[model samples]
Target chain A: MGNCYTFKIKNNFPELELLCAEINEIARESNFSEQLLFSLNVCLEEMLTNIIKYGYDDNRPHDIEIRLEIDNEIMILTIIDDGHAFNPLEADAPDMKSDLQHRQLGGIGIFLTCKMADKLSYERKDNKNFLKILLAPHVAAL
Target chain B: MKLTQLESTDRITNLLLSGSLDISGVKDVEMDFARLASGKRAVVVDFSGVTFIASLGMRMLLSAAKKLDSEGGRLILHSVPPLVETALETAGLTMVLPVVKDAPDAISLSQLQR
Candidate 1:
């Protein structure tokens, strides 16, 4: 890995702002493409929002760890959360063809991330959910 | 996020939004957006100033649009960036919250509903 950035945030929405700021700073320092930066933001928001919103059973504080690696021509993102076991790769696809009245709000975040990312994988290790995303040179922006 | 009503009347409502429509940003303007967009008038939003959007943002827009449709009103978005437009299309929202080229087009489209 060329440069690795790691962060740990409490599982809350307010805590996400700080991490997003750090990612913005990293994007500035590395001069990453706008598409990639947008994708990165989307990935973090979607994945972590799921963990923070629906990852736990009891009302207790939790910590989520995020790691971003800027290798030569690819960007690697790894998120670790001590929430319940859930695989994003198996998420139901959002209803993209539905009309406004019948549209479903669920799964749009993960669906957008999947459309933007080049590759994505999920694993449960040590009672934590590990979701890794790889974005190559192409972000598949339309 | 910042949401400003450029103009508002019984016939139409025009608003300008500038900021990332993330979780916090959504919280910042969702109430005002809903209030303005829920009225019995065509709502036009200028999206050129908006730099980023995601699912939360999409939900906000769709909710307003759905409310408008139920009330016989409509919401239109104009001057969107390509990337932001991509996200909207990905969510298939351009149909209900139609995207136009500029303020004039958005205003015209909104008025067309009347």
Candidate 2:
């Protein structure tokens, strides 16, 4: 059974390094798939960036705590933020087929997060929004 | 971590990006793309040089593309290097964003009367 690990980061962008690095080290040590590690990091970045940009409405910065656990072949990532209650999963889905010139730039984070993860869910628990993403075991390319 | 202008035409802009597009490079790329979005209706981001893109990099593209879209502009991607393409494809960005064969094609397509 792989153990879970937790780390805290300020809403600032650079603080994301700590979380990514930690996740990378753990994944390497645990022999997680490379694709799994990369996807997890990307998913984390998408969620954390949203929290940093919109969670507090660009006001005073706050903190985000990230937790990761692996069971069997699945990897789970949980992100919690104490800032203003906002849910990335609730953001309106993008009109993906729209012409490039007509598309909007925002919401790509949530879009990519949901797309990359095998399983994704969110909820506001005790006034904190917990965003979770799961990655399935890597499958060889066909 | 590395970005070099691959080609620039009146209709499209292609950039060869390499290394990791993560927290370290997001801000700079955002600022760079912000400037590129100015006065341009279509942009093509060539990922031929890129190997990996994290959430931070994806956010940069999303936000930048949104800005361009709001202005009645667009961003297309081309020649996504295999390593980086995995990330984008898995993210379903390949389906959402317009992708082309190479820089010239992207530019030509961007210039098409739409």
Candidate 3:
């Protein structure tokens, strides 16, 4: 079994970068590719930004916990935050082919996260939102 | 994010953007574009100061630029740093948008009908 790491951070955007940077370092230590690291960063940013924006009411601070587990060349990221129960997958997706004049921009973050991650799941348990994302190593070229 | 603008003689609006382009700053970019859209002028977004861009930020800029493009208006970008330029190019946006070297060059090139 691979080792697991946990981190707790305030629900702030700048602080989110620190979390992402840590993930990147772990990916490096685990020998994951650069592409996988970037994908993780992107997914984490999307999920965290959602919580920081809509999870808390007014200026109340919240705790966001991130867990990293390695399993058979896969990196699993589990993010838990005590914010409002909002499902990011439920958000509407933008039509990428739509003309600029008619295009809407708010929903692309979730869309990108969904596309980039190999596996993604979300749960709202005990008044907390848990989002899990997994990234697998790139298949070696033939 | 910090956004500063310069208006050229040919009525091209050059906006210099810096800092992280993420969900937190997307709203400000949208509002700024909406304010600029009210007028009939070309727009150029300078990415010299930008270091990182998220999907939301890219969508915001693309949506705004498309709006301007539809009304016989022009929108160009310039001075994109290496990392951002690589991402934009890889995403195939470089082909769709004209990018110049500097703010002055973007304004000068804006004169050429696209």
Query: In DockQ terms, which candidate is top?
Result: 1
Q: Between which residue pairs do clashes occur in model 3?
A: none
What's the ranking of the predictions by lDDT, best on top?
A: 1, 3, 2
Of candidates 3 and 2, the better by TM-score = 2
| TM-score winner, 1 or 3 | 1
lDDT of 2 by residue, A1-142 (tens): 7788888888887677776767777788877766676677778777887777777866776778888887767788888888777767678875556554454445656777776788778888888888877788563221
What lDDT does candidate 3 reach at residue B28? 56
lDDT of 3 by residue, B1-114 (tens): 778866544576767788767555565566876666434567878788886666666766676677677777767788887756755554445555677788778777877766
How good is the docking of model 2, as DockQ? 0.35
Q: Which 10-residue span in candidate 2 chain B carries the lowest summed lDDT?
A: B87-96
lDDT for position B32 in model 1: 95
Candidates 2 and 3: which is better by lDDT? 3
Pick the winner on lDDT between candidates 1 and 2. 1
Give the C-alpha lDDT of model 2. 0.72
Candidate 1 lDDT, tens digit per residue, B50-111?
Answer: 98999999988998999998998888899999999998988777765689999888777776
Best by TM-score: 1
Specify the highest-lDDT model's number.
1
